[model samples]
Target: MKALSESHYWATNKKKSKETDQLSPFKVLVRKEVSDHVHSWRFILLLALVLLTFFASLYISMSNIRASFSNVNDPDHAFLYLKLLSATDGSMPPFHILMSFLAPLLGITMGFDAINSEQNSGSLTRLLAQPVYRDNILLAKFYSAMLIIATLFISLTLLMIGGGLFFTGVRIESQEFLRIIGFSVLTIVYVGFYLSLSIMLSVAFRHASTSALTALGIWLFFTVFYPILVNLAIRAFLPDAAYLTQGEKLAYNELIMDIMRVAPGQLYSDGATTMLMPSIRSLGPMSMEQLSGAIPSPLPLRESLIIVWPQLTGLLAGSIAFFALSYYLFMRREIRS
Candidate 1:
């Protein structure tokens, strides 16, 4: 009777697992990863950091905007909400810039231990022994990280919009609100590029520490050193920059900007700049001929989309390519050790 009871227990568990698999094992894996991230101390620390920057920037912006309004009329403040975000009067970096810098950290934190840690602990092979598919594991990992980022970004954006409405006393245009939404969504995508690359490293490297250090190295180089290198390259290409005519100078600067866009950080900053400040009419330094007769006005949503579409696509493409490469590597990797 005891032997029959054990057989029955195993049979029941097998049936339940089969049903669960049919229901989509990926969903179960995603839920587990999401729950782990939400509860982890690492996530709590990142959340606190995000909130610190979010509120500091928002409060400073409110004070600045209120001060600006002390000397202005009411109707004109309608289109001035963006000034609260973009034009920091020596208090703190703009909300967008702060996010641009810290957002990558969140991605890195979530993804750098995604795969290698499990492998290092010897649970990776056991996990594969389960009913879950291999693709489901990796896909769940990436998607869960993306979902967390999207939630954080959306919440922060709504918080900013609410704070601006209540404290900034500026009338936000409908178009401006839509643009802000688009900007928040694009920021998540930009962060995902880093998240995907970091996960790829996690899969490729044996040690979680090594993968994390590699990711941080890439981030530091791109964020800190790449721009300087790009500038030097521009100067190298233009040895006599001082002797160039204004037209030549503008052309060279545009070339420099185009080359810098190859870096994901630059692409994101350019997109964020264009989204947050619609008054920016051009990415490159504008010649007088181009600026002549140009009315200083905020562009419509459609025009801004057209401007930043390339950057958006680039971020998306980089993320997908890195994910595919990671998937390939993870599949080829053996756990027989």
Candidate 2:
């Protein structure tokens, strides 16, 4: 009876310990990921590259602004300053464009070997042999990549804002500041999508190089070649559609635009332009007067949200869906060689 009681107590304690371990998996994973990232040469190189690109872009923009000021007729050219201030408006920074192109490559580079490298080194078996769950490992890797990518984006954003203020001598308005933050968040979401895809590919492919190559191919297809292909496809299929009457063309164009919003980058670009540019009061089937009349006399924040809500939701939803799909595929993948 005594021995049985002892055994029961031990079993209870063991189960309690296991439960505790399972409950804290994410924290453990995050810690390990943070540690690994700190030691990675890739992380350092990526940071350096991003910083370099950002500074270079800032210099170019400043140089142009200075030239414009020098060529000004009035010593106090308020209009020239306003134009300089608005330079960073509407679209993303040029450096951000470069970063977006580079972000996937960095994500793929970081994630392509996540599982395969461990498997190759025989660390995966040993790690799995411990109390850790397979799903935890995948989640940890993803979270780590996201954390790192987000940090990089934040750093780039601060750099741009600082550079803009320093070179242009313009104080960023509250709205403009908020817009920059929104742009950064959008960028992080975009990078997150690619990171999750990379994680999925890492799990799917045995060779890290194969995963990287596949990711690069997809990135090129989506970013560089896809737009060209889309344009060609649109032109080929709708040759006469572009020449239609204004009202009919607007309806057709709206339909096409809705379909094209499937691509997050394009969607982001369109939505961002519309939001940042105060001059763009009308978009599709609505005249400026009609749009102004549709809203409250003085548009409040909520009203503005209501107007762009569809676009904001669409871009965010698409990003979430892509990441979710990647996560599902990654979790289901077998780690065995």
Which candidate achieves the best lDDT against the true structure? 1
- lDDT at 115 for candidate 1? 95
Each prediction's TM-score versus the true structure: 0.88, 0.74
CA shift of 62, model 1, Å: 0.9
lDDT for 268 in candidate 2 is: 53
What would the per-residue lDDT of candidate 1 be over residues 61-87, giving only the tens digit for each residue?
777776654634332234456656665
Q: Write the per-residue lDDT of candidate 2 for residues 1-337, one digit (tens) a residue.
A: 9999999999999999998867786788788887898689987887788677666666655656665456444322332323332344224465545655666666677777877778878888788887888778877887887887888778876766776677667786665565566656766766676776777777777888888889888877777777787678778877496468767677767777766666656655654444443334434455344556453222333443455566667755755665676667766766653
Relative to the unseen true structure, what is the C-alpha lDDT of residue 135 in candidate 1, on a scale of 0 to 100? 90
Runs with alpha carbons beyond 4 Å of true place in candidate 1? 1-22, 68-77, 168-171
Q: What's the true lDDT of residue 323 in model 2?
A: 60
**Residue 95 of model 2, lDDT score:** 50
List clashing residue pairs in candidate 1.
Answer: none
The 10 consecutive residues of candidate 1 with the worst lDDT sum are 71-80
Q: What are the runs in model 2 whose C-alpha is more than 4 Å off?
A: 1-23, 66-93, 163-170, 239-243, 274-278, 282-312
RMSD of each: 5.0, 7.7
